[model samples]
Target: MSQLNKNNLLPLESPKVLWAVAISFLCIWFYMLGARTLVPTDEGRYAEMAREMLATGDWITLRLNGIKYFEKPPLQNWMNALTFAAFGLGDWQARLWTGLCGLIGVFSVAYTGRRLFGARTGTIAAIVLGSSFYWAGMGHVNSLDMGLSGMLAITMCGLLLGQDESASPAARRNAMLICWAGMALATMSKGLIGFVLPGAVLVIYTLVTRDWRLWARLYFGRGLILFFAITAPWFILIALRNPEHPHFFFIHEHFQRFTSDVHHRSGVWYYFFPFLILGIVPWIGLLVQGMWTGVKEQQKGFKPLLMLLIWAVFFFFFFSISHSKLPGYILPIFPALALMIAVYLESAKPNALKLAAGLLGLLGVVGLFSVNKIAHMGKDAIDIPLYANAAPWIAAASAIALAGALVAWFFAGREKVGKDIAILSLAFGGFLAGQVAFLGHNPFGQYIAGTAHVAAINAELTSPTTPIYAVGRYEQALPFYLQRTVTLVEFPDEMEFGLQQQPELWIPTRAGFVKKWLAHQANHEHAVAIVRTDIFEEFQKQHVPMRVIGQDPRRVIIATPVPSQ
Candidate 1:
């Protein structure tokens, strides 16, 4: 613990240097938020939701593509809608909420680490979390996971900071309020799991440590008030407006999705382990030693480190056992892991840091050499060109990481520079490398965004209100790009619940779509339909009236054929 007292070894000792690095990283961070195109099904789905919310001015009942959507809560949509309202709709604006949430997670963890441990641990924890692949990568994306994770990070940190025996009574009360409020917003961000996961962790922590005194400090009466104040109104309003939201959202979205493979997202028990390792990235070498140290260092009274362990390990197992699984499901655990890693790095042997840096450098070299293989990752011809276009940016990212790793290795060996510069160099490298790779992915993402077909669809539009049908398929990003909702024809994927609520919002049968198309054709009305290539072929075989407006190998955009002269 005395090693943490040596401020010289910390990266934050030099205020000017730290400020320069912080400002530069933030610039790149915010810049990249708008730089990348939104990809499906998360990015486009969320963005379009916000766009519709802004358009319709309906904050209570959530809608995706003008149909009722209640798979998750509306906190993120509210933030995103607010972003669109303030900034007008754009790529950066769509992602602003997520970007801010990721930043908030990083800074909050840093502050918690500083308060619980020292300034050194605080700065290092920020570096580890901010540079980690999953956290950093998803921060730029507009997704519900990052928003939920950010609020959870606050809850975890607030609980730890408030429960610390050294905290004054007044400080404890304030921090606990923040913790409760975080849980409320977190619940609004995702679902019940926000508070439920943390509640379970706290219970497990108490039972194992026998810290019976810890429960007294929770301020439950006040906390619950704060929680409901932030969370209850929206739930009440939505339930009141929709009447059916409670059953589908609470029962179907939460319980059914977790207990069964209702969403069809089930994975094996070890689903999150690989992602956890990859999420650790350049810090992987420090993980074991960090967790071991966290376990070993136990103090009288409160056990913050033990609580962190329970938080991470419990959530890992909880999600792994669930029938529903996703790469982002485990995101909330990263902040706790970041704090543990920071403590280990602060007093770690120079050789260990060097080895970690060297391994990252090796990964960079391998990435640089193997980047050409990215072109082959495409499943079809349309994707091959996009992958090829992204290869150069990925190569550049690898080079940047390699250079930073080498610099970190050199500084790790120097007693004077110590771990401060080495940690900063490695973190900066990893963060920048990720941003570059993300920026490079825009070409591929544009196709997924369905932006390429937007112009042709617009060109075929004889009227601004011309009907655009999604036949047996839904291009998630297309409606967002076109800034208008498309009528669903015979396919309801994630929108099944939403469509069930408003059956008139979609056409449920091919015969119904044919009938509608012939009606439009008879009226000499121009209409556009976006369909999969196979579906297009089927429609062609049926002699449906259509003319190709635009197409890729994956999707064909067709318009009503001109009436016979």
Candidate 2:
């Protein structure tokens, strides 16, 4: 009965209850992995790269739409390509790598939390991470950041577990090696920052905590060998195959992208703060409490909480000062934040927990009322309908959150039931709510994906040999849907580097595209082109003979007449 007096996170104490919750949460988590359309830029781009890899059977030289693409490393692409090999190409297969990474972060943090702190803290940490809005949401999306973050979590957790004095000598060596390997995999996932950022954090940790002895535990000799073993092969192979790759990938992509606004992704210093807040979702109220707990924590031995604090703060400032900033860039700090928050949640006062629950409920209510505003969020008239279509999902997500928060609030102070139920309700609620909102986004995602026109475009094709061209524009998602590469005309966009390497892959001018289209017509060969609406209109005014097979607000699919029979 005394156990009932504990906080709202009761299920953590019971093995049966914890397993039951884990199974249910995982089912929903995996189900949503394949539930949505692959959106542009990230989702479609990565998925198509993997598709091309699988199609072409070239593993080392990564290509996008049949052009050399070297914007990042190949770990995620390799995993995604492997996933496609096993499961076949689809939304879920593309996202499986990221989804697994998210799970890896959750479980690793949980295990680390259990090892460094206690069982309760570890269990709560997993709950906090698995449900956090950014982590949970990004996990389901096919993106590189989650993959990096997940591996980074393993590195951080391994460091924490390996450094603890209680660990046996063999355990310590093994954990440290895991830490090194994690960093290497993370580097392969994104870039050098995987190991660089962790190294910087370790340096700072050593200086701040003055734990000079901690350096000896790094196992650098074995670790460096392991790191290179994981990350070096592809770098060596790709550079050997494409000489231009070394300069562009190493210097231009990493250095120029960080120090200058070359990518046009510059953001103000505080840009990530808002994302961090919203990303934590229902846990927003406890962020301060968690940080405060970390700041005030002081121990004689290895300071795990302090290490976490430094990890989070260093990353926040590092990216804040970078010339390029995206919301996902700050993801590496979340695992540390989860561990800090779990420590706070373990011994939090009932009244404080109640207050946080109340605030979460209020947030849900606010979201419910503001959901209608989604209709106005669209920048274009066509997108307005899609945004409106997603409003109901927002409302449903909000209601679920509100319901969970209320239950949590009620159970916060209940001695008979304990706080376990309360925490579980809110965490599950946040996870489900985020998933619902993501599901709601499919209507707009589909519009952006141009999948609605894939069938129409396919029907116009006389055979698989029908030539397709993208004129004055690129539809990132369409290539994956069509399962074939299109000839690019008068546009390079992100594929400029790839185009530069192989100039024959695309037409450089509209005049050239027009000439090619005419030649195809003269040869009586059926060919399709996805033209920007304005370009299509311009071609129409120029008396270009083509049949409109399919069109959306953004683009028009024009096809040449079939061969004379």
Q: On a 0 to 1 TM-score scale, where does candidate 1 land against the true structure?
A: 0.97
The numbered model that scores best in lDDT is 2
Give every collision pair in model 2.
7-419, 8-419, 8-420, 9-419, 9-420, 10-420
Write one digit per residue (lDDT tens) for candidate 1, span 1-565: 3354466444466777779978998998889888877899899999999999999989999998899988899999999999888889888999999999999999998999999999878988998999998999989888999999999999999999889899899999899988999999899999999899999999999899898998999999999999998999989998889899999988998999989999899998888989998787778778888777658876888988888888999999999999999899999999999999998887888887887788789879988988889867877778778888888888998998899899989888766465677888888888888888888888878877778888899887777799999998888888888888999998897899888868999999988998999999999999999988898999889998889988887689988889889
C-alpha lDDT (0 to 100) for residue 205 of candidate 1 = 90
Model 2 scores a TM of 0.96
| Cα error of candidate 2 at position 195, Å | 0.4
lDDT of 1: 0.88
Clashes of 1: 0
lDDT, each prediction: 0.88, 0.90
